[model samples]
Target: MRGRGHRAGRAARKRRQKQESVVQSVSLCHELQYVRLMKFLHQRGFTSTLLQPALFTDTGRGLQAVKSIKPGQLLISLPESCLLTTSTVLDSYLGHYIKSWKPRPSPLLALCVFLVCERHLGEASDWFPYIDVLPAAYTCPAYFTDDVVAVLPSGARRRASEQREAVRELHSLNQNFFRSLQPLLSQPVDEVLTCEALRWAWCSVNTRSVFMSHPSNDSLSGQDVYALAPFLDLLNHRPDVQVKASFNDVTRCYEIRSVSGTLRYQQAFINYGSHDTQRLMLEYGFVAPCNPNSVVYVDADLLCDVLRGDRSLDQKIKFLKENNFLHNLTVSSEGAGWRLMTALRLLSLPQTLYHLWKAVLLGQVLCEEREEWSVQTAKTLCQRLLQDSHTALDKITNLLRQCDQPVREQLDVVESLRQEERCILGSCLELLEGPPRQPDELLSCAPDVDAVS
Candidate 1:
């Protein structure tokens, strides 16, 4: 019996060791690929002396600073030849096929097709080293399961569905174009340029591309703004990072300069522009922790629900819609946004002073009574939103415990968004709890507090 127990313990230890070995192997494989990609970039006159590809605990994969970087220093640059663009597509073997095709493909389609085709070429492709490092799958909502997307906040879910549909429609719309390339392909173009394949390429373009503008290629219609900068695309985004990125004609390279220095061994970041959690998740498939620009949107349905009790509901709704105050209502760390305040004021206006509607929008305060009503309406709406936030959080916690990585990643992003919304609502709710403020009364910004607990 003792011998049997000892044997079981040894077997368990062996299993643990085997799992650890596999993890190490995978990590080492990633490092080798990154090394090859770096070598590939260096050969093409693009180089990064201060940064190396690394797996960040918080941000997954990002470029890490190997040496302390000084402010206003050129961090990294990619030569014009390294940029994967419509111009690049036009120069590839597909050049004549694209040039003579009727109803020319859009600039975006040209890039997406190039990505999918090159990926199928394996090591035979010139861009193989760079392509090998690209993500096998993306976490963008476009790839999300219906169950996962259903868990997103209302505004995010709506946009996610629209994006998913657009990608599918894009694949459908370009069936003829994908078919047109069959004769030029080494293999069947349909098999290589599938819906799933196009989805992957589309996401890569959407998330990893740098805004690049060059002389428009006559082969494609639409603006040529997309450029896949190999090593430069690996830099992660942080809302607070200061940097200047531009195509320098003198150097003939796309250069990124840091305004604020990065510390040695720290993950380097660039600003993706002041995007909130919603845009971050919808467009980029990640959530920024403690995003100062984060805000909780009050969609039209919620606003309508808020104003349902008013006697002039239809009139007020029509007025708000006509004046463009019907949507984009939001609450942020800094009290209510101007649009929300404006809509609330219109709803709270007395029937007698209806002509002042336009005036109210221009920042005119009607009366103390109307101000009180707006404040109360905002408070009530916030309470409902706060409750919805709590419920959404609970749902996410349950989902997290039941899922695996990848799906777990998507759920985690949605959870971050809900948490941010909770904090934003908490800030807004606390403001409303104070003395009755004016219709146009904007409160001083407050520190974020998570009310989920």
Candidate 2:
């Protein structure tokens, strides 16, 4: 009995030891991947010692400052040889075969095909190190399942639907193109150009590419509109930080300089222009909390609904469409933009005064007492927005409450977006409901009619 008990304890110890070895092997493999990627970048002229990758609980993988980086200092400089541009695809090993194919692929499409080809080549591909690190999936709303997309706010849902359609079209195109190339290549077309693979490549280009004009002497005309920069693409986005990125011809390098200094161990960020949350989420698959550029889109259909009872509604809609003032009605932190206000004013106008309102918008005339009507129209619009926003918020809140466990992160994103909309709507309501001012006082506070037009 004593010997049997000792044998059981020995078996447990061996199992524990084996498990530890497996864990260490996996950790070592990840470290090796990191090292290989870094080594590849170094060989390609990324010699900056100040920046290194670090994992963060909130942001996943991002570049961290290994030492204090000063303002105006060059952080990264990749020579033209390293950029993955249209020219690179055209000059690649696969390009020779694709040249004879009828109906030439656009630069963007060519890049997607190039990525697919390289991926199939596996370890033999020159870009294997870079391709290995590409994200396996994206969180962009366009990739969401239909059921998940249906619950989004109306404007977001519409945008997501549009994006999904675009992807579907691209997949069809890729399928046909790949079929034609199958006989010319060793690998099967279906293996290289699956819908999922095409989407991964397309999004990799969409999310990480930068725009730059090609060298003047190159055969490509105009500009190389999109080029994928390997290491440079790892820098995450922040709306507040300003970065100066440009290709320096003299230096023959794509250089990035920081306008805002970063302290040691701090994450460095770049501004991808002043994009609203919806645009960011659609393209980048991430949202910045408290983004200054966030805006809530108020659909033009809502305004049409508001003016449904107005007898002149059809005429107003006609006038708006003719004058090209019919779209992009939105509300932001600063309140509604002039386009929304103008649409509302046009809807509120009587049929007899449609031509006169057109003249006003064209800056042909100014009415002295127009403030009262404008103010009233703005208040009505604000009230309608508030009601709609509250209803959407309540629906989202109820959905969240019904979940028995923690909701998915995507749902959390939807809730955050709706909350922002509600907050902005409340602000608009507060401003519209403030004590009424005399017509002349309100007109004095308003922007110049010509400038607004």
Q: Point to the candidate with the largest TM-score.
A: 1
* RMSD versus native structure for model 2: 11.2
Report the lDDT tens digits of candidate 2 across residue range 1-453: 000001011111121111232211011114665677777877877776877766543444667787899998887787777788887887887576457555656666778888988888888888887787776556566556664576666787898888777777887865666887676456788877877787767777877787676644233333347778876776777789998988898998888899988988777777788888777767766565568888777676776776566665676788788877777777776776667766665554555455556545643322434444555656666677667667765765666566522234445555556666677767766766676444332212233322212
Off by over 4 Å in 2: 1-30, 183-187, 215-223, 358-409, 437-453
Tens-place lDDT per residue, model 1, 1-453, is 000001011111121111232211012225677788878887888766788776544555667788999999888888988888887888888888889887888888888889999998889899998788777767678888787888787888899999999889989998988888887678887789999999988888887888877676667888878888887887877788999998899998998999999988887889888887798778877766767888989888888776665566777678778888877789887788888988887776545556767777778765665566677778888888889889988887787788766676667667777877888999988988887653455322222221000
Q: Candidate 1 at residue 441, lDDT?
A: 55
TM-score of each: 0.88, 0.81
Q: Which candidate's lDDT is highest?
A: 1
Which regions of candidate 1 fall more than 4 Å away from where they truly are? Answer: 1-30, 438-453
